[model samples]
Each structure stands twice: as structure tokens, then as C-alpha cells.
Target: MDKYAIIKIGSTQYKIHEGDTLTVDNQNGKVDAEVLLFSDGKTTILGDPTVKDAHVKIKITGAVRGEKIVVGRFKSKSRYRKGRGYRDTLSELLIEKIELGGKKATEEKSIDEAPKKAVEAKPIKAEKKVSKKEPAKKVVKIKKPVKKGTK
Candidate 1:
């Protein structure tokens, strides 16, 4: 089973696996990614916000600049115009490995030594009942026409 993990860098989240290369905002140097979730194909573990004892090793490969973005402002009735352009620096990263509970995800148990424990089926929870409310109807009042001379 292929192992994978979800990690957060800055405010962005990315799903990554070992040996994967990803490009993101500049990090200046190597960063230890915060793992939000991890799955070993056979088992899945979720965190309240972030998984405990889970970490993703990342290495910064190189730095590159993003595409140029042009900004322009114009006003009518006046010959006022301004233009500007800029490029964002991006960093290329390589995913080294994912560690779950201090154990490397790449490590696998051989079939001969695999446990034969029975997998228990989890019970499904009941869905919540939502009450539907009707939208309010707008009321319009009709005004009677008054004579031109009448106050």
C-alpha cells in the first residue's frame, strides 16, 4: 500500500508522498512540515487539528520565480494611468519521508510475519435531522391616487 500524508506549509495545505517534488512559496531553508493527516493504505489516522507525533521531512531543492503579474489602474474623464508588474519567488521542495508515531511509513511488514487479526467493522452514525424553514414573503402596499387639488 502506498503511504501518503497531508501537510501544511504556511497557510497552504498539500497532499504529498515520499519522493514527490513540490513548488511553493519561499521558505528560505529546509522546513519540517506539519502533518495534518496520514494514511498507510491499510490504516488511516486523523488528528483533531494536526496528528500527534507525525512529521514530514522536506528538503528545499532550488529557488525559482513565478510568472510575472501585471497591475494597471485607469480613470475616466482624466488621463490618469499607472502600471506595475512583479514576480513572486518560489521554492522547489522534495519530500523525503513521512514519519507516523515515530515509525517511518516506508517500512512494511512482510506477509509471512503479518498478523492475522480480524478487522472489526465500524457502525455508521445516524444523520442529523434539519428543520426546513420557509422564506418570508414580502408584502407590498398599494396607495390610492389622490386628486391633484386635494391635500
Candidate 2:
């Protein structure tokens, strides 16, 4: 069973696991997030606002901009119209590990582990070109039958 926890960053709450990446409201400097709840699949711990001695370690990766939002205002019979667009500044965070009951669950690999090598890129082959030709049309001429006495 995997371990999971509910944590609060700013005013938002997120359910996260070790090694997960999160995008939330911009955090100035370091963030001291609070752990709301925690579960280790077998055991569950609840907090009255926050858990005691439990910690969730996170690293701020970078800052990002959220999707643009358009805001508009219009007043009837006033000939007044306004429109604007803006994006919220957001921050990206990586969950490093979670600690509970003096035990730590780490998502990062140890320095003794060997690093993986990058795979070599394969060359792309050119596609075969095809020429399209229009098919010939057959024309059939229909002759009206001659009237009995007229040619």
C-alpha cells in the first residue's frame, strides 16, 4: 500500500504522495506547509487542524504563469465597456518526502545508486512520395431514334 497525505499550502488543500509535483498559488521564499491528515494505508492519523510532529518536506522547483483569464464589464445605456486579461503567478513544488512517527519516506534516490544513461536518437527515414493522376472519363453519345417519316 502506498502512503498518502493531505497538505495545505496557502488556502488550498491537496492530496499528495511522495515524488508528486504540484502547482499552487505563488509562494514567496520557502514554504512551511501544514499537514492536515495522513494515511499509511494501514494506519490513519487525523489532526485537529494539523498533525503533531508530522512533517511534509517539499522543494520549490520554479515559478509559472497560469492560464489567461478574461474579465469584462458592461453597463447598459452607459456606453461603458471594459475588458482585460490576466494570468495568475503560480509556483511549482516537488514533494521530497513525508515524515511520520519518526519514520521517513523518501522519494529521492541515494547517491550510491548509479545514474541512467541517455538513449541515442534514431535517424528518421524520408517518406516515399506519391503522384496523384486523374482517371480518364468515358463519354457515351446517345442518338434519338429518327421519327417514322423524318430523318
- What is the clash count for each candidate, in the order shown? 0, 0
lDDT for residue 7 in candidate 1, whole number 0-100: 90
**TM-score for all predictions?**
0.64, 0.63
Kindly state the number of residue pairs that clash in model 1.
Answer: 0
Candidates' lDDT values, in order?
0.86, 0.87
Backbone clashes in model 1, listed as residue pairs: none
Runs in model 2 lying further than 4 Å from the true structure: 77-79, 103-151
Q: Let me know the TM-score candidate 1 reaches against the reference structure.
A: 0.64
Give the TM-score comparing model 2 with the true structure, all chains together.
0.63
What tens-digit string does per-residue lDDT give for candidate 1 at 79-128?
A: 99999999999999999888777664434456789668998999999999
Q: List the residue pairs that clash in candidate 2.
A: none
Q: What's the CA RMSD for each of the models?
A: 15.3, 16.6
Residue 13 Cα positional deviation in candidate 1, in Å, after optimal superposition: 0.7
Estimate candidate 1's alpha-carbon lDDT, on a 0 to 1 scale. 0.86
**Candidate maximizing TM-score:** 1
